[model samples]
Target: MSDRQTPLLGPDVFARRQERLRQELITRKLDLFIAAPSTNFQYFAGYNPGRSERLIAVFVPAKGGSVIVCPSFEVERLTRNAAVQDIRGWEEQEDPWRLVRTALGEMKPQHGRAELALEHTFDYASYLRLAGVGGDWHIQTAQPVSERLRIIKYPEEIALIRQAIAITEASIAATFAALQVGMTEREVAGRLSEEMRSRGAPGGGLVQFGPSSALPHGGPGGPKLAREMVVLIDAGSPVEGYASDITRTIWWGDAPSEEFKRVFNTVHDAQTAAMQFGKPFTTRCQEMDRTARKVIADAGYGLFFTHRLGHGMGMDGHEVPYLVEGNETRLEPGMVFTVEPGIYQIGKFGVRIEDDCLMTETGLEVLSHRVAKL
Candidate 1:
């Protein structure tokens, strides 16, 4: 169907990832890291069984091998692709929390006063169960440790993300070419979805038009496309487990008003400024946001730019190293993220341009570049 190549990550990559995570755990002074069924677990284990009422987790001890705990029926399925060898299965009637505790006890015999970091996705009930397992253990969020590891991309990971971006760009181009003045927002979104899926994307994302485009993260079912309306399409595709997120806004027909051109140019200039400012070892994450915000603010459209400048993009569309106020994480080589600056005027129109960028040893490398012109 699709001409794109799907690269496979070998066992060596998984081994290295585990080693890095274990090292990070030690550095963070955490004894054990527990991950529920989430992107973090999939990142390590290479298997993504959807989350459910039943408990499924990967337990990584600071000193030793990782283990997965899941339902009995899923043991075989999980083992087929998961890199971790030790998988403990719980019967439907058994309490999985006890099994998890047993596994942790085996991994660390001196469990008393142990420090454990739980992935953020764990449900409250699961958290309480695991918290009750050992009375003296310290429990905290695993975000710091996990986010640190996932924020940096491996070469193979970047390749997958690139493939996804390529597919997404093609899909958006097709949607734009096929769009008509009378087409509904839903119809345009459907066309975008068709193009993406036809190109082997797992799914399609958002497409908004006209006044609805003024709302960030707007849904479909809005008014039909009209002449001189702003069209905004924010969509992405997943390649392997990595993701590609991009957004582009355009005027449907004829030249837009001078005000619209000014806003567009301001947003474009803001994105350019952010990209120019993003450099490895030098640019703090929030600095990118500030640089972009300054451009819009100076142009007198500061209040219209409603959201943060950007966010980290990888396995999850939005992740660590967020480009927003209060985040002081410095950019580093191998880190990938989005630099999207927008101007949304409620009841009127919106304009946003996003590009996925990789922080390289030299500087920022823009990954999604097909739709650069506004």
Candidate 2:
């Protein structure tokens, strides 16, 4: 989205997010909570950050008003953007513990009442430091509330995701069409990234090609694009902070050997099967992962199907609701993630098919167009 259009959440919008969080907190018996970063803070405080370290502590009392503890500099912004009743600040010189102590002083929660739900954002070291203000206020850290909330998409969130997916879909299409023998894998990735940015996508990406595809995350480098090798271009676009993740493995040159074609078709069919069955409320996320692997396995490439079938992608590229084995997280409607099935034989070559899927009210929808071209 453009700079003019902000994250769809406004002050009152944040209040709704907090209402849900407060209910969760109350259920968990948390009297006060300190959350941080773009999504969580934005969810509760309606505040977004251009950079990190802008700490925001949102304290929702079980019985009374909620307060946002912030650095002195951000108090004004928080006041304007937040639906909170009180704005607490600490001077840059003074230890933030002054405000932290004040907020904690009031919340005589049962035991873990005054706690912090730190997402991937909080460093363990920082949590250790907060241990300094130790007292009856059991200042503890837990997984962020917002991360769990963002796993499900709201209407506006789905819109941004659709735009991100469109841009990504177009970018991949262009990349496939632009492919030609003798161009480097780096070149193909560059073409796609520039196109995404030009089409209003956040530029730059994680892409790899050739035998390097064996490395799921081998980003751009000076590797030559060759014939008879699969070009694995995994890229995406972002809109209003929502991101889409997609990958396409386009093989160039003449038709492959009997073994390679059989494997490629099997993977293609595996990707299709995985998508056909992905839907809300399925315990089959791991089953979906296994579906792809089983196909590759029956064809004798099971070991090569590295990495999970997908991961949650919304405000952040990777979020919750991961589609992997050993994970029993139920897939739900409004959930968005990738269904990327691949076979990577290290050092020789790799082939992967990735696409974005949205678990809709009806069933699974391919948000990112899953088309192979090269």
Candidate 3:
């Protein structure tokens, strides 16, 4: 568990974020940046307005103040949590896109084809309606702007993720202690969920046993855990929007096969080598994946290791800076991601060991505690 206490981010933090993004907007030569009711909304606006068919959004200009648009009925509720004062609420029958156009008019002088960056969560229907709003608007992805800021963690964000990982690790440990033979995967998953919530976590995680472990993302149900079967638990709990992800595979029975032990060790070593790599803030993302993949392939189980080494984790479980083949993004400090290397033998068993890792000035800091042993 982290010694740092996770506290609520204050208005100052959001203000800093908004200012930073505005600079990014100017750098990208964009006119305006719009965020829907997604993580980006929660990120910049300091609250979530909840997702609906209604076109609720936050509009930030490249050089001026921001505004929010939501249903007129929701104005009061949104006001309580939002820092933006210029809240424009439309009635049920009103054209919300017109309101968006009005907000744009107040933002900047409309040059030729004013470029607008839309948060990726907006549906195609929303995009079409937005495009129809006219004013020579050009809608492009907000990826470069959003991903650049979010990919790097502030110290507070790291603390929150650590707290979340502590909760999930404790919940998984508690759940396994109470496990017994013949328990359905759903029952076990339910118990895990209960454990996490009881410990103040937002939710539970994934559980699999025996052949189900081979599926990687297998749902929990139908399978009954038996002695000598492999047990896999992949979980993440969020703390104040930051996320934690961890996966641990273990042999359930007292008697374990030699092959299982060997596979487990191979995965453990692969993850270790990848984590301990001495590169500092400049190693290509795929280079890290290759480092781990080589270890698995050397053990003659490369074919079974089908998936990427890991993915970036933050407000979303899977985000930018993916540690996989072909991605060339360089790893930088404050970036957090998972280093999970797994080998699955179809219809038989699989082994995976994952740890939430933070890249540092020196090396990777393993955030989650390693609980499973050979």
Choose 1 or 3, whichever is better by lDDT. 1
Candidate 1 lDDT, tens digit per residue, 1-374? Answer: 12222238877788888888889988987888888877888787776777888888998888888899999998987778687899989999988878877876776636356888889999998888888885667899999898989999989999999999999999998999998878987788888889988998775877888889899988988788888888899989898878999998888789887877888888999999899888899899889999999999999999999999999988888998799999899999999999999999999888989999999999999998835444
Over 16-133, each residue of candidate 3 has an lDDT whose tens digit, in order, gives: 8898899999898987899888788877877776688888999988888989999999899777777677898999998888898788777755555678899999989988888887
What order do candidates take by TM-score, descending? 3, 1, 2
Best by TM-score: 3
By TM-score, how accurate is candidate 2? 0.86
Candidate 2 per-residue lDDT over residues 1-374, each given as its tens digit: 11222456555666777777777777766665566554665555565543345455666655567787778887777666567769888787877766766666676655443554444455666566556664645654545455566788888788888888888878877777887767876677678888988898675565565678788788667367666766777777878677888777766668765655666687788888888877678646787787777888888888888889888888778877788898787778988888888888887777778888888877898877666432
What stretches of model 2 exceed 4 Å from their correct place? 1-5, 50-56, 60-66, 76-86, 110-120, 180-182, 254-260, 372-374
- Number of the top-ranking candidate, with lDDT as the measure: 1
TM-scores, all models, native as reference: 0.95, 0.86, 0.96
As for candidate 1, its clashing pairs are none
Query: Residue 285, candidate 3: how far off, in angstroms?
Result: 0.7
Candidate 3's C-alpha runs over 4 A off are 1-7, 110-113, 371-373
| Alpha-carbon lDDT of model 2 | 0.71
Candidates 2 and 3 compared: the better one by TM-score is 3
